[model samples]
Target chain A: MKMIIQPRDERTQPARIIAGYPQTPLRSPKEPLVKRAPTLSELSGPLEVAKRVKLLGGDIAGQGEKQAIGQLIHLRVRVLDEDGAPVGGAVVEMWQANAAGRYIHPNDDDHAPPDPNFYGAARVVTDESGVFELRTVKPGAYPVPTRDGWWRPPHVHFSVFGRVWLARLVTQMYFPGEPLNAQDRILNAVPDAAARDSLVARYIPPGVEPYNALVFEHQIVLRGRAATPAQP
Target chain B: MMIPTGEATIGPFFPPRYVDAGANDLTVFEGRKAKGEAIEIHGRVMQEDGTALENLIVEIWQADAGGIFRHPADPRHAQADPNFLGWGRAATDAQGNYRFKTIRPGAQEGRAPHINFMVMFSGLMRILKTTMFFEDGKDPVLMAVPAARRSLLIAKGNYEFNIRLRGENETPFFDD
Candidate 1:
């Protein structure tokens, strides 16, 4: 006996873009009309820390040797929703203190030597499964001004690109058991005790490489559906 | 309540349109898209009674570095930040809510007015982009509207202005 198969809809099928493989409903007038989610602001915590590098003052500079770390630091971040379903096409930007606790910026007055070889910034779009992997080095903790004193734990800042319909979240990732984490003013500012702890990265030593660095896994959620606009 | 009748001057910081057209390729030094931080600004736009109104389309535009416009009226300057496309389109939620993710424009000297936005909804047909001034702070004449908008902006590191949008509670408008 012969059997009849149904035709597949391309728009509903998983579409691949440079960012990631985005899966949406088959877009059609009759297809219950699931709206595409709004693009959210990017997560910019571990990324926007002011670095202290020589300002390239309107001059052409050659590419230097900052690639010495060889992308050894591994960042495996999973983008999820409140229900824990993987979110695809999430954009991630990561920049942190080099292994030596220094950044590349023009206004940095720290006078610490910068790795001429390192740009210390990288960007990647998440995969179809909402997973993004970045290979780099662990950044050392740097000090910033505080009322009582200067305090900062070794951590990475993360910024997320989210939808207008959803809430945008920006947070930092800290290694567990850092002494200064308790005293760092920024970390103490999160308001929720659980949310504060969620920002800390758990350690998984051994394997990966000979000089194994701590691995951090961060999960992000998209909140608040877009409300339908009212008629004037 | 005074309906804003004055002219509102906008910007010298408009973004110059990009010659390139890539969504993912964001290289700042090359005038490509840069990675912008993710943030959420959600709230309701209510009347004096806090009753929500809807059907408002919020539009935003800002200037890039060197205070230039996208596809500037004049040429001969550096390119605009591709990632910083100084324009956006948003409609209020069922509760008259609108949000956007624009960076705070930096300051420029001898500019027209403050960096204010053009908000349109209600009986307004066309998008009414307005230039708003702070209560009694800077000279609107010396500031750029894009920069002024950045003034009340909120972020992981800034102050946020919650607009009442109606009555005398609305922001000041400029003579454009």
Candidate 2:
């Protein structure tokens, strides 16, 4: 079945080419994005990605006797489609810096210390209700690796593969009220406050089981599947 | 509540743990070869100045040799080749070269067989969605693209599709 996919709302999204972000000027096309009709290629995607990639489970802090260092936090992420319906079996790949705001990658030459107990990468699949939880140390705000005078706010990078190809999303989830978020070029790339606010996770006070970690809940809305034709 | 979430870069420091070794070879999976004509997709990802964009993730999704999508949405998806891994991901090397070992997809009705490429990397604020047609024919979708730039969507010389992030001859991108 062919799908009538929806076009992105450019206003609520970042400009195709953003300024001040040095990479955009070199990476973005000078011409406007081409609009095309949807095809099965865009409607279909790989299934069981988490199975192929292997799920690292919800614990990114590792199984060491000594847990990762820094503020313990639990992140609850729920993925929804454009119609506000849960996306089940979606693969949510998350990677972030450790408590000191340093990544395990060799390229992360930031002055922060990398925690041996934290590799900082996890693949969690949303349950039938489109919910997944992650437990790790709060990533610290670090200076951009580009060595620009800017400090990026504490954020977790997310790569989600929804049920269909059209629903694919690679985005960042920001913490609320972070000082650097105001100046973070990536976060400010989208001029709309409401759109920017959607990137921030809501704070829920720490109190429940595994009570040591504060909880931050975030919701990600992917492009919805096109309307299916009615059956006779 | 229904608003789409904002986009962000995948960052240069792709977690090594996510780089599954030999994930690019989709021609075979689980000790079995897919039933189709195997092909190689080789390409480089460069910046506006032609600087190699290393560690960039290039993911491809395509139909089977029969143009049957393994996705359940396809009415005949059940007929899809079980050994065929419909999609795969590969990270560019130090020199910005990424390769995919897969089969040539069969053309869907009224369309040409092609591979869908989604690129993600640091500084790319949004996901880059594009397609690579095996050969130019009467693909209607390609018709919508500017004629002068349509060749940018076609892979040149033995499936060598280099992706230039910007500048002259920049690859055309689409919104999903």
Candidate 3:
């Protein structure tokens, strides 16, 4: 049967600009090519680690001195873009140690101490300028298994949301100048010295009462950079 | 503004960065570098009877190829972006066809979980939401591609991913 081919211009109409769905129109080469939504490169940011929520099940809050009531580790974080603008609609999840410096999960098994009431898990979404906060206790040092041997350090875990499974991240925020930091293998594995240092927060004694509480200010960064291709 | 309708329920929190980040205009790019590959994201949103529906708004989000989210909370574990959201929106066409041209999201934290997606249409009661996974290949090497591309494939040399609405054979909720 004889076939009629459509004109090239007629076949190459750009996709109809749908109002909301930003990623659409998968472009194609052949005829009758209705404009295809574009395929985007992977997105990135400051923190990208994945850990199971259900798996985090130890308790580390509710211990320490009675003065520990307000001994929470206050976190002030700002989320920004390449242009230094705050990003809206992003979500953040943080899990940290309680006042007694322990995790609230049963799996943590850090017998150094126990804080029955502390579960150290909270979730928050960003507002118009991409800022989020978490009221938690300064994580205490805990002995964990490692290749060299067992080591302990004070730290908290954090996760960010891009959307759904994509947004999930699992990472720890360590306290700056903590002696144990020098021995932590994972902490040392980070190649970027400054980036690695950024993960550690400094403590400022809370001004109220006995001044036992510690305050940490941390800034997290998320970026999408591909490793250089391996040489043949 | 189009109000979401359907049975799907969404969580109350957006990342602090998303909440505080300012607005961005999507209409600024003018070159091929800014141009994304267009693909047919055709799928059916059905009733228990498997009947197709229309006018539904399907949303998607993913990180760029380098595996960084446009938003601040990305799992870079270090470098953060104050802007990129990696999120997008689209309404299904007459044949339950919905499409988007978003960057493939990176596999943060190692598990490489699928990105969450949601759909809301007219007639249906509450919003219907669910998560979608990148179609990673059987081999670990191939599986290493970012979650967004793993969810996408070259069908007839065209990048595409067909979405399915909740009912049977699809995920149940959005937040999980």
How much does each candidate deviate from the true structure in C-alpha RMSD? 19.5, 2.2, 19.2
Per-candidate DockQ versus the true complex?
Answer: 0.03, 0.70, 0.05
- Please rank every candidate by lDDT, starting with the best: 2, 3, 1
lDDT of 3 at B164: 36
Q: iRMS for model 1?
A: 22.3
> How many clashes would you count in candidate 2?
0
State the lDDT of candidate 3 residue by residue for B106-139, as single tens digits: 5554434344455544222223334455554352
Which has the better lDDT: candidate 2, or candidate 3?
2
Docking class of 1: incorrect
What residue runs in model 3 are displaced by over 4 Å at the alpha carbon? A1-38, A41-70, A99-101, A146-148, A163-169, A204-213, A224-232, B1-176
The lDDT, on a scale of 0 to 1, for candidate 1 is: 0.40
- Scored by lDDT, the top model is 2
- Native interface contacts kept by each candidate, as a fraction: 0.00, 0.76, 0.04
Whole-model lDDT values for every prediction: 0.40, 0.84, 0.41
